[model samples]
Target: MEPDQVLSVTELTREIREVLQGHIGTVWVEGEISNHRLQGSGHQYFTLKDAGSQLSCVMFRGARSGVRLSDGAQVQVHGEISVYEPRGQYQMVVKQVQMKGQGSLQARFEALKRKLHEEGLFDQDYKQDIPKYPRVVALVTSPTGAAIQDMLNILTRRAPWIHVLVFPVRVQGQGVEKETIRALEMLNRAEAHGLPVPDTIVIGRGGGSIEDLWAYNEESLARAIFASQIPVISAVGHEIDFTIADFVADLRAPTPSAAAELLAPDVTELKRHFESLSRRLGGQVMTLLDRHEQTLDFIARGALKTAPAYQLQTAEQAVDDLEDNLKVAAKEQLRGLGDLIQERQQIIVEHHPRIMLMEAAHRLENQAQQLQQKISHKLERLADQVTSRAQLMKHLGPESILARGFSYTTDAQGNVIRDAADVEPGQTLVTRLQQGQVTSTAV
Candidate 1:
């Protein structure tokens, strides 16, 4: 505060930067991006502007983690305000970036929405239908918030005895997303632990700013909602508020009261419906009975013929005819029995002892003749084969040649003498004739 005090340009800039950083911290500023430029150092420089004002901003490549934006696009910059000493200018050093106009919360929400939507998390086929009258309704939200009370009141007014369990959660601030996810998973586990499991769940909180509602927009909560075994109803904020949880839930209720209405049927209306159904059923049953009674009356009126005596006479005539038929049948049976007896007598005569003996002797003679023929045929085949073999032996062996008066001469050693040099002078030789072997001396 002294007038004699002097400050260097660098010092002044540094001081101003510190003041801005302390006051602004990391603030979110929304505007359209213009003069967007990328540097070789993997950093981006841009100016954020609106219809009335513009602000300088710089974002390092690390902060550009999502879809890239062009110059004419609206965006939001989350960074700290700082003064650049060299340029003597003030700017926001962007730490994070997202599309603007849709709001930072909405931008992140839509991005996550697109990702999960592509994953089929928001597909109608994957969603289960909410029960018209759920036995147990679980509310995953702040227990003390107005939303819970509103839901409880609506449920009580509609279905008087329907059960409601309030599971408390942090719906805003840091770690809110995790807490919400935990509540959902815990309820799912309740059934396995022999505790009450909800048939349907209503998860949300009362309306607030986009920041306050950001927990419902988290990707983790969206995934958890998709995975819940029970059908979920998203009842966050008022009729105008929308979140990622709403899109992913099986049913989306504009308000907590509306969700309660969806889960529980109106008792008065249900009773009226039952009564109407009962009346209709009773009417149908009565009509059927009346029709059956009319048929019975008609049948009773025609139980007997108009001339009952004539009908009785006709029945008597039929009995007489049956008796006559029985008598004729008995006579025919007697005739048939007589014929059968005659046939038996003829068969007995034919089966006498002498006749049976003659038949047996004839069969024996025929069998002997057949056996003799088989034996003769077998002997002829054997005789032919024996003669053929004998002829072959005579041709192949020396017997035929010997019988033709030819003889074989062998030396004393039993080797046949094919040449004169094989025989020695005065050596005994064996000369085999047709009938015998002769001994002779060789000169």
Candidate 2:
């Protein structure tokens, strides 16, 4: 126990570790997390601090899998204290982590929100449109709640014609989700059974805490809202309150009365619209009548020619003109016929057979002279062509070819052979000469 008996650095650190580990054993430390680092080895290291002090902490992977950790989050950690031998530093080895108080509820809320978001339940593409003018609004909530009465009052004041069908269900506590889901199913079933189907559905409650309004946040309820064929208007809690139902619904209303206001048409507005439409129709009819009257005036002005006596007089005038035109045309036609007959007679005189024969004989004589000249020209051209052909034949014929010392070979059938491959060894061949062909055979 003297000065010489003092421990070494490692030994001293080890002793301190043992003492702190034994004394602190499995203590609960509440602090805000900072300097958080999650290692690739699945170990999380962080500093847990209060306003006054800070402590190093570590959570090895697989210790608390369900808890999601982040910096600045207030958490209650359950673990034991330990020392890192190399650095001789002490740290809390956390075994379990829990979010504290309202943080806990908020954590769960955010967690569920993230889960539903990842599931595409919060997708706007899947959201339906709320009915603009719902004729039958199906109300799903507590029959005793104030939301239903407010909605009823609003609907009554705004649109007395819209029929509201109420389906009573618990809006909070145990079995609320199940009851709501069951009610939705029942309404859908009724519609499928050919009953009065709701054009729209209103699900809401009065303002309350997140816990009080948690029925609307249930996953099954959100799914039910998404699956509903009838457009859903979610009006849970107050304007400030938001639940999962708000995200999944076809339309989210700030309050129950707001839902009614959205679904119904104001009677005053409708009355104004009706008056405007009636005025427009009256104006259009008056305009149409004016057009008809103008058209009738135009017809009256032009209808003078439509009188029977006027029509008959017009027909008589037309007949007189037609008669005059016919007479003129007949006289002109007779004149043309007489001229044609005179022309035919002149033609007959001019084309007497004797005169025609004389003209024909003169033409025949001229043609005969032309034909003789053409025959002479043709014979001269033929003689030139024959002489040229003879010269070409003299140069190209076999006799000239033989004189040039060139020879061609043919088979006995007189087919000229150009390639040696075309002749077999025993095939009879003829050597074509200018004078005659020489017969040959294979050896």
Candidate 3:
């Protein structure tokens, strides 16, 4: 190389930056932190050192390191290796940081999470809906643990009718994942084993450190949960704690007690609901009957009264008596329904309340349909009577009398002259014939 072909300082620095970035693009470095400083702009500047050498690092505000940064702390950093061209110094552009003790475990966790996410294990479309009223639930956990006790207490208090099956297994430590997976498989094929099939399975344990909870993060356990036929609830830790099992399970409850709460409905609330429905149904029936009675009264007054005067009083009395009888019958029927509901409520402990309520409602509906048909038949009969009376009245009308060769005379004021004494001498009159009228003068 000749002196005349020497490189400029700017060119040299740019070439060094390119070479460092191209060769050692990204890396994870473990060291002790020194000279750590946080700027008002939320950027962190620190020096990572060991007994041998030190390296400059900068974490921008947008980077999420998760761990707190301070001098003298042992930490692991992930970033790109690049040179700051203006300063001509190579530094790590930090993207993430973790404590030295958790760095490897956290890395593995992140890698598995990303892999499963890409495989669609966490997709919402794959999630099954947990039954709102699960009839049977299976719990897989340490039988002696507080988690099982809490869940049992909650289930017993909220829904004493539900059947609970407990599968005891180690919730932590080595080979626990195999026990949990086996429990899930057994519950799914429970009928083949002469055990009752469960509507849901809840796998839970109390809160613990990441190491203690590591079994839940196993890929095989997650796969088993994903493949289970029954809906699975993951209640492995506290609210803030999460595991791969949580992601793959059909539903996630923050705690074991919460899982039980989700599965059970309060019996008292259900009873009140049934009672409210009974009352509303009874009230509606009464209202409908009353409206029908009013319609009957209107028909009797308007159409039945048009019959001959001798029959009019008798028809009105009959309609009034029928309406009173209908009212009494409806009241009796409603009273019987109320009594049936009370009796069923008393025996609810022996039979499923839902089935009992449904049966009662179905009977009430059938009775209402029958009553409606009866009312409709009665209305049809009353309408026929009205038609017959209308026809009779038409036949007995003045026009029919005129057609039968009977005629009436009206005086000058258009009043029917029923008797000869109603006319005076020389009074003008009009006599109506069958088809015409004749003007006449009294003689």
* Candidates sorted on TM-score, descending: 2, 3, 1
By lDDT, who's the top model here? Answer: 3
- Candidate 1: which stretches are off by over 4 Å? 1-103, 304-443
Candidate 2 runs further than 4 Å off: 1-101, 192-194, 304-443
> How far in Å is the alpha carbon of 80 misplaced in model 1?
23
- lDDT by residue for model 2 (1-443), tens: 79999889999999999999888788988999999999999999999999999999999988973356899988889899999999999999999887655446767778889999999988889888777777888999889989999999989999999988999999878998899888778787775766588988888889876667877888888898888887788999999889999998888999988888898889999999999999999999999999999988976877454686886788899999999999999999999999999999999989999999999999999999999999999999999999999999988877887977778999989898999989999999999766777899955
TM-score of 1: 0.47
Better of 1 and 3 by TM-score: 3
For each candidate, what TM-score against the reference? 0.47, 0.48, 0.48
Clashing pairs in 3: none
lDDT of 1: 0.86
What TM-score number comes out for model 3? 0.48
Angstrom error of the Cα, residue 58, model 1: value is: 27
Model 2, TM vs. native: 0.48
